[model samples]
Target: MKQPKGVFVTGIGTEVGKTVTAALLVRTLKADYWKPVQSGDLNHTDTMKVRKWAGEAAGTFHPERYRLNLPMSPHASAADDGVTIQLQDFELPDTRNFLIVEGAGGLHVPLNDQDCIIDLIQRLGLPVVLVSRHYLGSINHTLLSVEALRHRGISIAGLIFNGDPHPSTESIIEKMTGLQPLFQLGEMQALNDECFERQVQRVGQACKTLLDGL
Candidate 1:
C-alpha cells in the first residue's frame, strides 16, 4: 500500500498555536488529523479541537496512541497514569488522504525516558510544519528549532508563524535560515467556523506553492 502524504505539525514551544496551525493545514488539505500522544486535557483533546475548529470538511480525526490524563509533559503524564509509552505502541492509521500529525510540544518534549517528540517525528519520516508565534525571544527559538531539525536530518516543510508578524524578527530568521514562512496567522478575536474557513482560504492561497511542494 502507498504511504500517506503528511506533515508533522510541531511548535517551538507549547501554546504556540500548533493545534490551530494543524487545523488550518487540515482545512487547506482536507487531511486526516492525528495526535500520537495526548498528554492531558483528554476532555478536550487536540483531535477534538481540530475537528470542531475545521468542521467535517477537514477530514477524519484519528484516536491518539496514548491519552494520558494529566496536563503535563507526555513522559510525566504517562508515568502518572502508570503507563510506559513505547514508540512501538504507535501505528499510523490507514489513510490515503493527506495526514496532519500534531505533536505534543517542542522537539524536546519527552515521550519516554529515552525518546523525545523529535524522535517520533524522525521515526515517522514526515516533513514538519514548524509553528513559531511571535514572542520576546521567538526568533532565537525558531532558528534553534530549525537548526535542531536540520541537525537530525529531518526536513522542515516550512515555517508558519502564529501571531503578529514581527518583520525584524522574521527577516532575521529568514536571512539566517533562508526559509520564508509559508504563512503567518494572527490572533483571532472571534474564532468561529466561518472565521477559520476564511483563514483556510487565506493561508491556502498565499502558501499554494509551499503546499504544492509538500
Candidate 2:
C-alpha cells in the first residue's frame, strides 16, 4: 500500500461536524485516525461515532491518547481531572500511510496552560482540513481560522463546509479567501445505522475527490 500523508482536521467551533467530517476523510483515504486529546466524553460517544462512520470495529479504532471526563476545553478538563495535557504525550504512528489528527475545538482553544490547539497542530506539522458550518458568521470564522493557520505556517489542504444552508457563502468564501469549499455536507435528519452508512458513503466519495490532489 502507498503511504498516506498526515492531515489535521479542525473546525471553527464545536458542533461543526468536525469528527463526522474527519471520519469521512479517514474512511475515504482508508487511513489511520487519532484524537490526541478528547474532552467531555462521558462514555466515549464522540470516538464511537467516528469509529462507526469510518466503518471500523472497536479493535481497529485507535484510542485517544488523552481522554478527559469534563466536557470543556482541554485545559479545564485536565484541571478538573487533576491531570495536565501535554503535547509530548501525543504520538503518531510513523508507519501509517496517512494519519488524521482531529482537534477538540476551534483554533486557539486552550489545550494547556501555555499551549493552545494551534500549538498542537503546529507541533504535528501536518496540513489542515478545516470544517465550517453554513450558518451566519461562518465567513468570519472560516477566514480567521484560515488566516491563523497560515500565520502558524501550517498548510491548509482545503475546507469542508459542513451543513451549508446557503449557496452564496460557498462562492463568497472561495472568492474572498481563495480557499475552496471542498465539500458541503447536506442535512441529515437522523443518524441511525442506515443513515450513518449512507452518510459515510456519500462523504467518502466526496472526500476521495476533494483530497485527490493532496
Candidate 3:
C-alpha cells in the first residue's frame, strides 16, 4: 500500500489550539497521531483527548517517550528529570498512511540543549500545518513563522485559524500574506456532543478539501 502523507502541526504559541486542530485533522483523515514530546502532563493528556474525540482504537495514538513532570519547555522539563531529549529517540511507526505529528509548542520550542522543534520537523521533512489564533499580532507571528519554515526549506501545507469566530483576522491574513486559511475553528469551551459533531463535520470537510489538492 502507498504510504500516507505526513503533516506536522505546530502553533504560534502554547494554548493556540494545536492539539484540537490536530485531533480534528487526524479524525478527519482517520490517520495516526503522534505526540513526539509531552511535558507537564503525566499520562499523555492531549493524546488521550484526541483519541477519545477521534473514536480511535486503543493503539491508534502514539505517546512521546519523554514525558516530564514540569509544564515547561521540553528542554527544561527534561533537565529537571536528568534526561536529554535526543533526536534518535524520536521514532514513528512505519505505517502506510498519513501521520499527524503534533509539536509541543511553537517552532522555536527547545526540545533539548542543541535542538529545537524546527530541527525535528526539518529532519522529518513533513509538510507543516501551522495553527495560529485569529487575534492581534497573528499576521506578524504567522509571517515570521512561514519565513522561518521557508528558511529551513520546509513545506507548509497551509494555515489553520484556530478560534477565529469572526473573519476580521482571516481577511487580513489572506490579504497580507497570501496564505490560504485552511480552516477556521470556532471557539469551544467544552467538548460537548454538539460541539464535537460540528467540529467533526467541519474538519472532515476541510480534510477533503486539503486532500483533494494532493
Candidate 4:
C-alpha cells in the first residue's frame, strides 16, 4: 500500500497535550512518529514517549534533528548548545505506513532566528492536527491558532480537545473555523500504553479516513 501524507501534530499552546495526542495518532494509524527538533528534556522526550507506547504498532520513532540541552525555546536552546538550526537540516523519514510529525510548542515557536513551527509545517507539506486543551483564555488561543494556520493556507486535519470538555469553547472554535473535532480525550488518572490504546479505539475510527486522505 502507498503511504499517505503524514499528520503534523501541533497544539494551541505549550503544555496543552500535543505529545499525548500525537502518541495516540501514531498508535491509531500504526504510523511512524517523528519530532524534528527537540529543545530539551532528552531524558523524557516526546520521541521517548511515542517509542514507549508505539511498541507493537510497528511505528518507527525517528530521532530529533537537534537535541538541544536546555529546556528552553528551540532558538535559545540551540544557541546554548552552540548549534544553529536551519531549514535544510530537517529531513522527512522514509516509511510506508502513515507518519505522525509532532511540532514543538505552538505555531509561532521559533526553531532558529527565522524559522518557526508553522514554517516547518509548510516546508514538510504535512497536514496538521491541532490539539487544544480548555483553559481560561483557550477560546482566543484556539481561534488565533486556527487563524495562523489558515492564514498560511495550512491544511488543518482536525482539532482534538485533550481535557475535560468545555462545550462552549469547543463549539465556538468549531463553529468559527468549521474544523471538526476528531476526538475529545477526557482526563485519565493513569496514562500508559493500555490507556492510550483505549483512547485509540474511540478516536481511531473517526480519524483514520481523514488521516489516510492526507
Candidate 5:
C-alpha cells in the first residue's frame, strides 16, 4: 500500500497554539489527525478539538498510543500512569488520506528517559510544519527549535505563525532561519466552523505546494 502523505506539527513551546495550527492544516489538507501521545485533558483532547474544528474535511481521528491523565509532560504523566512510552509504540495510522500528526509540547518534550518528541518526529520520517506564536522569548525558542531540527537533518515543510504577526520579530526569525511563513493565522475571536472555514479559505492555498511536494 502507498504510504500516506503527512507533516508533523510541533510548536516552540507548550500552549503555543499547536492544536489550532494542526486543525488548520487538517482543514486545509483534508487530512487525518493523530496525536500519538496525549498528556492529559482527556475530556477535551487535541484530537477532539481538531475533529470539531477541521469539520467534515478531516479524515479519521486516529487513537492515541498513550493517554496519560495528568496535564504534564508526557514522561511524567506516563510514569504516573505506570506506562513506559517507547519509540516502537508509535506507528502511523492506516490511512490513504493525508495525515497531520500533532506533537505534545515542544521538540524537547520527553516521552521517556532516552527519547523526545523530536525523536518521535525523526522516527516517523515526516517533514515538520512548526507553529510559532509571538512572545517575549519566542525568537530564542523558535530559533533553537529550528536549529535542533536542522541538526537532526529533519526537513521542515515550513513555519506557521499562529496568532497576530509581529513584523520585526517575524522578519528577524525569517532572516535568521531562512524560513518564510507558509501562512499566518490571525487571532480569532472564537473557535467555530466560521473561524476555521474562513481560515481555510484564506491560507489553504499557501499549503497546496507543500501538499503537492509531499
Candidate 6:
C-alpha cells in the first residue's frame, strides 16, 4: 500500500473523540500529528494525548500555534487571552512525513470573527478524515458535516465511526453519504500503548486504504 497522505481530523461536534481518532490515524499511518490552535489544557493538550497514546509509531508531534488558557471556543478563548486569531496566523508544519491535524471542534467552530475551522481546513489544503460517534443527533450532525465539507469543495479522506456501534445509525449515515467507511473504534476505557496497538491492528488496513486513496 502507498503511504497514506496527511489529513485534517474533524468531528460532528466537540468531545466526539477527534483526538483519539487522530491518534489512531497516527498509529495506523505512522504519521506526524498537529493541533494548530489548542483552546485550553496547556499541560496536557491534544498534541500530548496523541503522543502518549500513539506511542513510537507516531512521527513528529507538532506544537500548537495558539495555546489559549480557557477551555472554550477558539474565538472566546482567544478573547480571554488577549489574542486575535487570524487566518494567516497558521502555517502547516514543515514535514515530509504524513500528518494528522486534529481540529479543535466541529467544522463550523469559529477561530476568529472572519473564519471558522472549515476555513482553516480549506487553507491547509488537506483532505478531511471526519470522525463521527453514535449518539442521539449524530445522524443529523454527521450528514450536515458531510454536506458542509462537500459544499466547500474540500476533499474528504473518509469517515471514522468512533465509540460504541449502533448499526442502524451507522447504516443511515453510510446510505445517505455513500462515504467510504474507514473503520470503527470502541470507547477506550484505558488510554495506553497497549490499547493503541490493539486498536491499530483492527483498523490498520483501512488506514492504508485511506492513504492510498488520498
C-alpha TM-scores of all predictions: 0.96, 0.88, 0.90, 0.95, 0.98, 0.96
Answer with 3 or 4, whichever has the higher TM-score.
4
Tens digit of lDDT per residue, candidate 4, span 83-192?
89999877788777678999899999998889899999988888889999999998899999999999999998888898998888888888998988988989966778
Candidate 3 TM-score, true structure as reference: 0.90
Residue lDDT tens for model 5, 1-214: 5566899999999999999989988988888999999999999999999999999988889999999999999999999999899999888888988899999999999999999999999999899999999999999999999999999999999898878879999999999999989998899989999988888899878989788766
lDDT of 1 by residue, 4-99 (tens): 788899999999999988888888788899999988888988888899887877888898899899999999999999999988787677898889
Q: Can you write out model 2's per-residue Cα lDDT over 154-214, one digit (the tens) per residue?
A: 9888788877367787788788778866767777677555665676666665667655767
Clashing pairs for model 6 are 4-211
Q: How far off is residue 25 in model 1, in Å?
A: 1.0
Error of 6 at 160 (Å): 0.7
Instruction: Point out the higher-scoring one by lDDT: 1 or 3.
Output: 1
| Candidate 1 error regions (>4 Å) | none
lDDT of each: 0.88, 0.78, 0.80, 0.85, 0.92, 0.90
1 or 4, greater by TM-score: 1
Count of backbone collisions within predicted model 5: 0
Ranking by lDDT: 5, 6, 1, 4, 3, 2
Task: Quote the lDDT for 81 in model 6.
Answer: 91
Worst 10 contiguous positions by lDDT, candidate 5: 1-10
Candidate 1: Cα lDDT at 73: 96
68-167 in candidate 6: lDDT tens per residue? 9999999999999999999998888888899999998899999989899999999988999899988899999999999999999999898989998889
Clash count of each predicted structure: 0, 3, 1, 0, 0, 1
- lDDT, residue 144, candidate 4: 95
- What tens-digit string does per-residue lDDT give for candidate 3 at 38-146? 8987765788778877665223677566778899999999999998899887666577767888998899999888999999998777889999886678778887888
